[model samples]
Target: MKIKNRTLLLPLAAVLCVAALTGCTRTSYAIQTNDARTIISDGKPKEADSGLLEYTDANGVKQQISKTEVKQVTELPK
Candidate 1:
């Protein structure tokens, strides 16, 4: 009874510790748009975000990306 509970507790504690240490790792990237202007996250080129780009992934459909998701700020053609 007590031994069984202790055994389960050890494994559960270990799992929780690992999860706390390694949460979700998000990487940010710069994406080029049809427009020459570059948009960056954090309102700066040197800043980073959770993900490189923020896009809506529909069922079996092309990814709908937002212009603001872009992580680069550059000049656009006039």
Candidate 2:
């Protein structure tokens, strides 16, 4: 019983370890707005239609703001 349980847990443990390591990696970008507020993103903001800046935020949500409202966009140091 112990041997079988150990074998079963080995693969599960490996899967969990890989998931933990891969999930922790993310690219951080800082977006400064004209209003003096900063937004965090997981990727570089891109120009979108209707003069909008689009990006995926740190929480993994898709976001868009007016391009005119953004002061600057920069990637954060790793």
Candidate 2 C-alpha lDDT tens digits along 41-74: 9877889778999899877899999999999988
Q: Which candidate is the best by TM-score?
A: 2
For each candidate in turn, the TM-score is 0.32, 0.66
Clashing pairs in 1: 28-52, 29-52
Give per-residue lDDT, candidate 1, residue 33: 62
Worst 10 residues of 2 by lDDT: 41-50
Candidate 2 structure lDDT:
0.90
Estimate every model's Cα lDDT from 0 to 1: 0.47, 0.90
- Kindly report which residue pairs in candidate 2 clash with one another: none
In model 1, the Cα lDDT at residue 56 comes to 21
Which runs in model 2 stand beyond 4 Å of their true positions? 1-24
